[model samples]
Target chain A: MKLSKSEVEHVAKLARLELSAEEADRLTTHLNGIMAHFEKLQQLDTEGVAPTSHVIPMQNVFREDVTGPCLTAEEALANAPESSDGYFVVPQIVEV
Target chain B: MTEYEPVIGIEVHAELLTNSKMFCSCPVEFGGEPNTRTCPVCLGLPGSLPVPNRRAIEFVIRASLALNCEVKEYSDFYRKNYFYPDLPKNYQISQYDNPIGRNGWIDITVDGTVKRIGIRRVHIEEDAGKLIHASVGNESLVDYNRGGLALMEIVTEADIRSAEEAREYLVNLRAILTYIGVTNGKMEEGTLRCEPNISVRPKGTEKFGTKTELKNLNSFRAVYRGVEYEVKRQVEALQSGGRIIQETRRWDDDRGITIAMRTKEMEQEYRYFPDPDLVPMNFSAGLIEEQRSLLPELPQARKERFMKEFDLSAADAEMLTSTRAMADYYEEAVGAYPDYKGISNWIMGDFTRMLNSAGIEIDASKVKPVDLAGLLKMIADNVISGKMAKTVFEEMFNTGASPKEIVKSRGMVQVSSETELYPIIDQVISENPRIVQDFLGGKEKSFGFLVGQIMKYTQGRGNPQAVNQLLRKRLSETKG
Candidate 1:
């Protein structure tokens, strides 16, 4: 299944990525090339093959709900592009 | 013109009461310096892998079982990809195709009729960071303190027919969650949230009209109002040949209207895919059974048992069992004193009043259940009159002192003995000669006046029963 140019554009829009026309065309071609390889695999189908989302053959990997140490606010905000009053500041997203 | 019925379903997102974040070990609590509760995994730092929280999953199972949902044997976690400032990860770990629980049902009562709401799914997800819009600048502050906390979303089928029914469902859902100790269920604290998506259909039509989801319904009253107003708006739109657009609307509480949220918000498309870092949850029958075993007596069962065991009215039993702590308090007090009616009366009356006026919950009150029962015992033992118990109760509530101490310190023992009350009754009879003559002259209400005088002279410490009897005898002797 080849991805159309518009589909790539839609994906880029949803991901908040600005793609120029050249970048969009390149993505569409690269995405279809990637999909063409998957198309080759669709030719061979084992009817009884079970669907699996995990390849590790594992389940129920969990951690006990015991609290450990947390990062200090200064350390947590050190990597932010902009910080103010111990908060990560972003452009206003909410209209109201 | 045909009548249309409003079709509504509610979604409740409750933060699980846990000690740590969903995927990390940061403490899960409210009101901390912003971002102090962050860890690499919760903040979605590169190279940090996510692990499931065992207790959080168990909490969801307990709540699902309480709602009568079937626990699935296996469920997978998905990454819901979206670009929002509040979500540091840009993709929230949630459940999509398979959730922890499914097909549960809960019963809510409205207009004296019990209605069952279908539980569509109960899935565990991580909470997003809180966004505080700045008042002075065109910027918003992000607090990751609430980020990655374990949250469960309980979605219901479109079974609610009216606003009142929707309100009842929310009330019942909150009670169940709080009773099971899964969540604090405080809407004002933002630990619990309710959203209802509403639509209307023609009376005989099988198809549903378009729906608009409502947000910012912070309280039960707001839920009711938002649903009521949305239903009206949809009906008006249909009547005027206007089509309802499927969008998300924000409830403007001050203006009491549901305004469509910005169109950008309407572009929310969560591309869901199973997350590779976390493994799928596989619940053994043994685990499910164990969770079911740990399910405490829910509100409905406790309410019924309270009515039967304590011989309380249904209303009183329901009130007592409204919250687990309050019900437990009542049971503990009853255990100490065993006067069911007396304890019930005090808790429902003055005790509840004190708790409300003090702006605290029953568990936070200074008055212990045993102490309250002790006060009731004092009234029963004739150590104090019912009138005097009020003053003693206030002291007990304020100081956390025993009833005996408060009564003794105040020297407010009841004058129950006839010998002690007789002199006071005689003094009242002689001092109130006009009331006596008024009584003898067939003005029987004047007897109540004489009794009031005696009670006043005793400083309201007169045992009502003994005072009534002794005063009657004293008036009979005076007539002779």
Candidate 2:
């Protein structure tokens, strides 16, 4: 069930992770351990048992069509790490 | 062509409409400042334990019952461990082994037929924050505004046959969620999301094939296109003797393609385990029944009623009942008129056109149900001709003015009295003797020209029905 170092590296690349060698090795073991748990699912007596997807016995939940409060410009910009006036400020990408 | 079959399943994540966050009292409004709505519970601060939102639980249960799902009286929460900046808690608190509902079926309309989509489970969970990828020096920013939002994951069995069917099922599910008032079902706002499981097998094959989970399809069109792209891609791969790999695909709405995002992970990917902080849920039988009774008339029943009572065609019924507000408006208009065909024409023709133009929904219209009723009544009682009603309708929509008041103020009322209409009719016959010759020469459409002339003389206020009667009677004797 263990993923090779190359496979671990490949997965990290796909996920766009900047993993160190140690982290890569650690994730290899973690991914393999996770795959092993799924392997146990193969042994369940699921031959005729249907796979369960939802747990609630309810349906047709709806709301009245109405508009609620929208965010104010001040409230919308409150949490930005950087902001100016009433908008979220980010580093400029285009050169003048 | 080797017989190929399509296996389809739907996963719907519905945001529970609550006044506050799932585990905190912070306002659960969308698009607030990144951290303005956050509290210790939603921010995942140390020593903050989440108390379940009772209303959220009830809403989920109500939704479950509406879908004919069996409610689990006792359920527990689990921790899905993952590492994402948007997820304040590295591990999300979700239901694993004991979800609140399971084994349900939802019927959706497809091509004038009802197709039942089996639901697998509906479980309560918390939503993560938003990650905005900025075009910066290679880093993305995380906004915690959406953290700790209540969400229910509705899983459906692979009972769908086509991408169109899958889209219909998703739309029906959204409609149900909105109708129950559980979620707003605003895909653009990310209140409701649909992830499709698609696979293709040899035709008539009983065994299932490898399925890929496609995500990021935020719109109905995207859901259909994503499933179609994946199905064709898988079928082509299998036909070429290439193995189908299980993976997670991201749907590109612009490109209209499904791109492989990452390899599909098994259950251990998140390292799920029961959370030690939260208590297990225990509900009484009465609570479940109460929640079930809270459900309103669902779309299927409403559609059937529209066909039976309103005598609407299948297509018109489908269009009208797609949303609750539209359907409600249609009924209110009908209640005012009691003339099914006339009301349908007004709603489907002018009402829809105005709504589309103003970018407003029926519920949000300034003109209320009584306003629509007033306009239709003016036409029904012949206080105003059908042609004059159009002008009054524009005034009603523009100023929220009642049809009666507008007609009285602008002197737009039709000449319904025979005494009032006969003078206009006599003036028209004497002015246009040649046009009457066309009517006598078997030119039936030319009668409309005479009506137009009569209407012009009355400044478009002539009672059309009276004018028609008078024109036919006087012209019958002048047939030289």
Candidate 3:
């Protein structure tokens, strides 16, 4: 369960984070230490135990199908970094 | 040449027909002003929590039951982490380990043989926003109106062996979904979409070759063509002693070729974990029973029933049951007039043509179900000739007028009575003496010519059967 430096770099690239060489090495060690601590719990015999997804026992928390109020165009675009003509603008996505 | 077989599996995404978004109260609509449907929960703002839509879950359960899938008593939603501009949250809330439904099967008829395509799983997820790229400038815009919408992903096993089978499978699946009122299944509007993963393997080999994922197939025809191109490309590469590479491909529809987008090595690892904000779904036996009762007669079942109940041919039944609205229209018309074949002929023939040319659905057409039945009754009662009925139908379709009104106003009544047609027949006989001589001289084709003349004289309103009988009696009388 040890994390490799390359694995950490790959994860950082996927997250769109520009990590330096020093940060990558340090993060790898930190992640490995966390994984090693988690590995200690694997020694316990926990067969037939269901994996819990949520801490709360609540299920089927939902709202009705009816629509309520929505944000106006100006309000929605207020926090956007860049906008034009009632839309969020971003860099061009190269077609594949 | 070496023998190769193509293996294909299709994954389809259909937007659920709900009033609101999947986790937010923004209206789930198709087209609107950009950013008008945004909300904090959908925009993934800090401190905003997601609450699932009840009707969307019910829809998924109903769809699962329709597809003969096993509904799990407990299913949890996971956050599939990814980075995309259209994804506001940078992670899509989807089901991974425990999907809502699994192990279902759909039957598709390929070349007259019913082949059951295995359904791997059906899960619910939130849709990303739309990205619109400008042509003149190097800029892209995002419309969050479609963000956080409920979408159901239906994945099928690699059971399809040909492009035709894939096409049929999609067609049948769309029909079933539309029949259950879960999704509109409109592929043109991007509400419904399909992506096929295709690979080639040696004939009689159990192992599958490297498969490519195809995207941007907008229609069923595109699906068929894309799979065909991919299968051919793979087979050619194998024949040339080249190894197939797993990649994502885009269908170049205009060129009819699949272009590689990215290889599998570039595939992102979607770290999926349960969403902490939303709770898992739990269904009781009573709830499952209630959802099952909500299932309407699906397309396949209704198609079979149509064949048995209406005594329709397989092709006719398939055409009539193509869409739920069309099927309902057919049934209502049949109720008004029990002549099953007669109603089938009109709907499958004239009504369908009108609908196609006018670019409208049967329910949206001016001619209602009762109107079609009434027009068919006129043909049955000899009030109008079949040829004349076509004209009347055109008029009725354009004006939304009833059949009786159109017939009376246009003076298109059939001249079926003996007394009314006798004089006209006599005039035609005298004027076309050569045709009469030919008829008496045993030129049997002249009889048809004479009938055509009478119909022409009566402005295409002559009862053809009555005209045929009267012409024969007069010809015999002249001989005697």
TM-score of each: 0.95, 0.80, 0.96
lDDT of 3 by residue, B88-125 (tens): 89999999999989999999898799999999999999
Model 3 residue B416 lDDT score:
92
Worst 10-residue lDDT window, candidate 2 chain B:
B262-271
| TM-score, candidate number 3 | 0.96
lDDT-superior candidate, 2 or 3: 3
Give per-residue lDDT, candidate 3, residue B334. Answer: 92
Best by DockQ: 1
Model 1 stretches astray by more than 4 angstroms: B252-256
Question: Candidates' interface RMSDs, in order?
Answer: 1.1, 9.8, 1.3
Residues B202-268, candidate 1: write the lDDT tens digits: 9878798898899998888999999999999999988988899998899988999999877665367
lDDT of each: 0.90, 0.79, 0.91
C-alpha RMSD in Å of predicted model 3 compared with the true structure: 1.8
Q: Against the true two-chain complex, what DockQ does each candidate achieve?
A: 0.83, 0.07, 0.80
